[model samples]
Every structure is written in C-alpha cells, then in structure tokens.
Target: MNSKVVEEIKIKGGRVLTLVEGDITERNVDGIVNPANSYLQHGGGVAGTIVRKGGRIIQEESDKIGFVQVGSSAITSSGILPCKAIIHTVGPRMGEGYEDEKLSKAINSCLELGLRKGFKSMSIPAISSGIFGFPKDRCAKILVNETISFLKNLENSSTGIKLVEFCILGKDTLQAFQYEFEKSKPQS
Candidate 1:
C-alpha cells in the first residue's frame, strides 16, 4: 500500500520488525527474485517457500534451466505469481567458502539482469544465508551494503529499482537486517 521500498509488515506476538513477510507482488514491483539452487526444481529452503507460495510455475520454469551453475542469474515469466517476472539466482553454497564474492555477484547480477529485462522494481530474500549456510550476521551485513550500493548507483534513474526489499523468513533474520540497516553494523 505504501509505495515505500522498505516496509515493515507487522504481525502480533512478534518482535517489532520481526514479521516482515509480505507478498512481493503486492509491492507491485516489476519482479521478485528467488535465491534458487542450480536445479530450478524446488525442494526445500527458500526455494521451497517461493515454489509453494509463488506458484508451481516457479518450479516448472526453474526445471527448464536444466542445471544452472552457481553465481549465475536467470529470468523467467511469472507463470502464476502476480509479479511481471521472476529472477532466479544461483548463489554459491557455503561449504565452498566463496560466500563474499559469489554472494555479491549473485545480488548484483540479479539487479543488473532485472534492470536489463526492463524491470523497475524488485524484491529479494537474503541470498545464501539460509539453506546455503551463509552466516546470518555476515550475510545480513553484506546484503545491506550491497543494497545500499545498488541504490546509491540508481540515485535518479527510472530503470533503477525504486524498491529493494529484503523479505526475511523469520524473526532472527529480520532482526539481523534491521540491525544492519539501523546501525550500519550487522548483528552478530
């Protein structure tokens, strides 16, 4: 409802900033991205959630990718979601230890692709931090920096994303992001 890029989707019995879950499409953004694995076939993790809520097409199109390697971003029509498009990004798994650069590239590349595909708005989950195993605090800090950097570059542009939201999954993750945004210092 608020055209605000960052919003607090309040819910009862939760931390003030904890319930930051809202429909990415309701933001009326050009797109919302999923931090998906290479398979595109939704199994569990954020991919599972997006697949369940966003629609089956999320999996269908993702499956079409065959095997998306890490650090690359891809685009697909929102077969069932309200948003105009879906950007699936393959973030590096944590076990390999390339979190920083790979995560950065994934986020940056997703935005770049969104812009290139003619999208003016986008919503994203915290990439690599959940199932991908990126440390929550560190990932939150990096994500905040990356988003602010993206906004700084898009200061006065139309194709640039006017709204860049971090659709966190739970209270702890939400708090981490809030800490990062408020103090410019991520919570450990």
Candidate 2:
C-alpha cells in the first residue's frame, strides 16, 4: 500500500507486460487481462495461448458474459494460466472508429474491474494492437496513460494495486511497450 503520485513518469523499461512471445500462463499477477473476442472462445493467437494454458474453464466462465461489445469489459477466473483471475476485455477491430480511445477505455475498464473486484496487482497485454488492429505504439502509449489515469483516480487505491505491469510477448510488441513506458517515465 505504498503511496504513489498521480504524476507522469520517465521510465527505463527493463521489463514489460508480456505479449505474443512471452509465457502467458507463468505470470503471477493478482489478475491478468485478456484481449478477448465477444465469444471468449480460444483461437489462433493470444486467446489461444490462454485457452491452452488456462483450460476450457476459461472459455466457459467467459461465456457467462454473453457478448461484450468492443470497448466494454468483463471478468472471470484465469482457469489455469497461473494468474488468479482474468479480466476479459473486448477491443475495437482494425479501422474501428475511435479505436485508440476505445482501446484506452477498454484497458482502463479492465483494470478498474479488477480493482473493484479486490485485486492488488494486475497484468495486462498490449490491447487492440494484435488481431484487433490498433498500432502497437499507439496502443501502448494510450494503455499506459489510461492505466496511470485510473490509478490516480481510484480512492484509497494504494494497496489496491502496487504493481501494474504489461506482459508483452513479441519483440515488436515488447519494444513498443518499453518505448512508450520509458517515454512516460517521470524524469528523476
């Protein structure tokens, strides 16, 4: 429950939220967010990794949400991904209007949902930049900004989330998040 200012940061990212190349099931964040399709079923991408590692229970729980429109959110158990919970978020597809803003909204909403549900740490991937189509750099910047914004606004949020990390998997995705994170770090 350390106090953190709602201020901008200048970061040198030696790490980031793992993306396509990172191991999704090995993370131990209080919760991990998933960029899921409306159906929540696993497929040939990040979603697939989740299902493969976490198990069918992940998709089954997600099915309870029905169909979450793009930019909206839901939450469920991680099944078997090593994370305690999974925040299922649906983001805008490529060329969707206001995609970046919607992506930020989706990302923040997922975190907010996790926090409200009593999680103290959250791990999120680069939203909307993969199959959804938003540019990786743009999504990373907005994702970090929106995450910071939410942290700043949450009352008594200190212990609520001591660590909010991005889990990037691919080299390009990793570089994108790291670059934006470093750019956003507060100058010492």
Candidate 3:
C-alpha cells in the first residue's frame, strides 16, 4: 500500500496516463491487467500475488474461460480485489518468433478489452518482462507506446476509459517505464 506515483502525463483528450511503483492488486482502478499464461492459472509471479490478494474466485473465473491465446486477453471478475474486473492477457515469451509484435498485440488486447468493458480507469503491469524473459527496456517502450497510441485513438471514439496506469512492482522496472514514458512526451 506504499505505492508511489512516479509519473503522470496528460495524453490525448486530456486523459491521464500514470506510472506507479506498487502492487497492481492494490490499485483501485476499474480494471487491472494480469500477465497470465494461456491457461490463466494465477500460480506464480504477478499472477500469484493477484490471486493471493484478490482471492481464488479469480482463478475460478479464469478456469471458466479456459484458455487465452498469446497476444490476446480475457476478462474475469476481480474477486476480492479493489478493481471491478481483471483483464488476463497472455503475452509472448522472449525467444519466441515475433516477440515485439506479440507483446504489442497483448497490450492492445488488454486496452481494447477494457475499453469495450466500459472501464474508466485501468492498471497494467509490464507483461512478459518477468519470468517470461522479455527485455525490460523493450517491454517498457512497447507498453508505453501502445498505451499512448490507444489513448490517442480513443480521443475521437466513444470510450469510458479516461485513465491508464502502469503499475510496476520493482524499482528497476519502474525506472524503465518512467524513462520510456518521459521519452515519449510530445515536444512543444
């Protein structure tokens, strides 16, 4: 609960994109994106933390969904978590062919799913960057860029999402995302 707001930026349509150093399970957003395996098991890493804090109903709901393809996402109840919903996204592992594109698609899938679900705010982690072994810098860049692009495109469209947050746990990962976010700022 000691999460710090590392950075906040106003994107298109005045929507806010924030980077936070904390636990995603504790975020009080409309939705939280989980970096899940295809089976949707909340057994380890971020998934485990979510299941532990959110409760077993998350895995139960995911079991009902069965499987999600890499680069795709599925929605489920947030269980006991503060969020309204959990977006379980399957990101590609490093060394897989087309890792970059798959990671981008995974991010887009989470955002689009949240938008479709009429969520006004959502928090996401650095998908595939942990045990999946994707490079931190590349993951940060892809996630930030994709999120900014999605928000920009949503400006003219009807969407309930107004705030997107990158909730990172580790100090190094937070710094990487913060750097990417700052580098992505529009020059005046």
Name the best candidate (by lDDT).
3
Q: On residues 1-188, what C-alpha lDDT tens digit does candidate 3 reach at each position? A: 68888898898787989999999998999999999999998899999999999989998989999989999999999998999999999999989799999999999999999988999999999999999999999999999999998899888765568999999988788889989988988887
TM-score of each predicted structure versus truth: 0.80, 0.84, 0.97
- TM-score, ranked from best to worst: 3, 2, 1
- Give lDDT per model, in order: 0.70, 0.72, 0.92
**Model 1 ranges off by over 4 Å:** 1-19, 23-27, 156-158, 185-188
**TM-score-better candidate, 1 vs 3:** 3
Predicted structure 2, TM vs. truth: 0.84
Model 2 spans > 4 angstroms off:
1-21
- The residue-by-residue lDDT of candidate 2 on 17-121, one tens digit each, is 222335555677788888888777768577788888888888887777778877778888888676788888888888758877778778878877887888876
Spell out the clash pairs found in candidate 3: none
- Encode model 1's per-residue lDDT on 26-79: one tens digit a residue: 445678888888887768876676677677877787777788778788987776
